[model samples]
Target: MSSPTRVYVSRLAGLPVYAPNGDQVGKVRDVVAMLRQGTQPPRVLGLVVEAFARRRIFVPMTRVTSVDIGHVITTGLVNVRRFEQRTTEVLVLAEMLDRTVTVVDSETTAVVFDMAMEQWRTRDWVLSKVAVREGAKRFRRRGQSHVLDWAEVSGFAQVEEGQGATHILAAFESMRPADLAAVLHDLSSKRRNEIAAALNDERLADVLEELPEDDQVEILAGLDTERAADVLEEMSPDDAADLIAELPTDTAERLLTLMEPDEAEDVRRLLTYEERTAGGLMTSEPVILPADATVADALANVRNAELSPALAAMIYVVRPPLETPTGRFIGAGHIQRLLREPPSELVSAVLDTDLDGLRPDDSLQAVAKYLATYNLVSAPVLDDEGRLIGAVTVDDVLDHLLPEDWREPDKPEEDHHAS
Candidate 1:
């Protein structure tokens, strides 16, 4: 027989699968690998086929007679049931691409952008090599490319069944939310949803807010209704409202009802605002307290790590009935002002009421000028009654200022270098 054909998983996917009699059987949907063997390289198990009737089934490697860049020929026998993986099996594209892994020989880390497979004999295929683009950030550098023998890659193949998500979470635990979202956007939809589902609500919310609007909607749509609502609640009201506005009316209404009442109310109020106004960009929750609150209270609020430095740099003071539609806006006090006073001193004593508070309908240009004129990162938004309503954060304003598609990466299509 001629030398066995070699191909990559990316090339194999979507190729038509044929039977021994020259009959078309199905198309390749994914390649499955058994990871029970030692970590150097896992055993190639089978092909997940999308056959007639739109059904998905598994054809064991033993039944695969030949595989080439253009086609796969099977033994004309395949199990027609839906492909359910045993604990030892993994779907290559779903679980592996964009995965951070280490090269054993060089001890360098890289992501698996594509994998090469070698057909050693009739019906015998094995993972042969990995094609990785070496760079810490995808957009920051057009990194060097390297092809390494499959044995040189260590981390991913060694992980046990059901551990892929765990490993992925640990790999990205230290990444900034924006960076994490960028990585997620580069992955296949299947891999993207898997990582998104594994993340906790707060972390997921932060990542969601950092993603572009379409990505934010896609991630939310992948989640179950209740879990999606919970994540929405974890997001700032303005962010949540922006996402909800992109969803269909019925889906948006259902998710809103599922959210906690107060959280839903905040998002609902934000949704009513025009997109370019202060009201549209401001967060309903800010570090606000009564004018009589002590300097110690302001310090405690600022010290909370969850608040962004911009929001934490100052505190808003209001009169009695300090709530959303709060009592009259008394003034704002910066953290520097708070620290100079005694812990027992009230915010009312040092508050600077001279600065102009933003109105909900203030133009984006007006809001920008206000922040620039005062050198403030966050400015309070007040109503006709002078009740404190929200705070426009600089980050939100920057989002508007940046070009559309600013969050998208500039890379060309993924590489297709098969062995």
Candidate 2:
């Protein structure tokens, strides 16, 4: 019975749950605990296990024989019903992780990344340590993690009652990511990190892209390395590169290592370009199709939900040998023009071949002027051989033209007083 004295909920999740006869049962999906009368550690209730066909079942801790890194042993009998959360229960992974609460001893706030439960006696458990991280807006990841005793925590009552991060974020679901980012900017750093952690990778990436560089770095630091990498993958390559470039060299390399090779390669290529150049402002993934593609094909590509409005606004038509560095850039096709043409008409028919594109090394000022002169929201960026490498959108160009801290809220004017 030499089970671990304490365990992190994340480590417990996915561990095999076995029956008394050593027959493998379901896997741990989440840990369940109930709020207590006071600050005393909440009681460990059981494990929410996912059995065959992804069916979730409740295995009370009363039946759990032992819990180790790889396995959770339980009494042979399991409640084979759909697992549901009781009003008094809290699902650690779903309800508590990444929450911001005050550390009593420190009198400052910290985010909960993991919770530790200690075995008080045989089959008896209590919430014990919390793996927390705390820092100001500018702090780095070098030395921010700390383990706070359960007694040192307060304000988690809101989390136990299910009125926490998830609830707060739901209110912003209707807002665009950029608008949400603006709202988050006005909140405290802890709140920003909490919401960022609660968001899905794609949504978080969109919001992060809309945030200031300093905020982006801070929020990314709050996430575990794996999660941060996943969020980076969801962002456009140019935006991802910009964030990574702002991070410390070591941190940047580590995150890049965690990203998928294909995604990492795209960001790396963008990173090689100067931030003020067209290459830096351009997104490699755009609505691109062969010159022979029909208006129907162009429309379908533009209609993809994944493409941002700017990216979907115009379609780049390429010559033969279609690839990343697409063969000789033939011309660009506007979405409006494509819609006006018959669905059977080839994209080449509506293509505007005379419009010149920016070279990778073109200056940001040149890019802005080109967009303005051409009345375009996005303009293509080409390589030496006139290959379409990417496209720069007006949003990207405006990001460069505005002050670095433009997303930051303006400070209130100081009150003038007679001396």
Q: Write the per-residue lDDT of candidate 2 for residues 58-155, one digit (tens) a residue.
A: 78777777888789898787767656556677777656776777878757777777888888865588778888777554555532888888778887
Residue range with the least summed lDDT across 10 consecutive positions in model 1:
410-419
Model 1: lDDT equals 0.79
**What residue pairs clash in candidate 1, if any at all?**
none
Relative to the true structure, candidate 2 reaches a TM of 0.61
The residue pairs that clash in candidate 2, if any, are none
lDDT scores of the candidates, listed in order: 0.79, 0.81
lDDT at 267 for candidate 2?
92
Candidate 1, residues 1-419, lDDT tens digits: the string is: 23255677776666789887988888776688866446446678788776774455678877777776578888787666655556666777667766777877767677777787777645567778887766554454545678888777777754433223554565346667865685576555667777899899999999999888888888899899999999999998989999999999999999999999999999999998898899998999889998778999889888988898888987999987776779989999988878899999998899989967999999888899899999999999999999999999898898887887777654322211110
Which stretches of model 1 miss by more than 4 angstroms?
1-164, 412-419
Per-prediction TM-score to the true structure, in the order listed = 0.63, 0.61
The deviation in Å at residue 242 for candidate 1 is 0.9
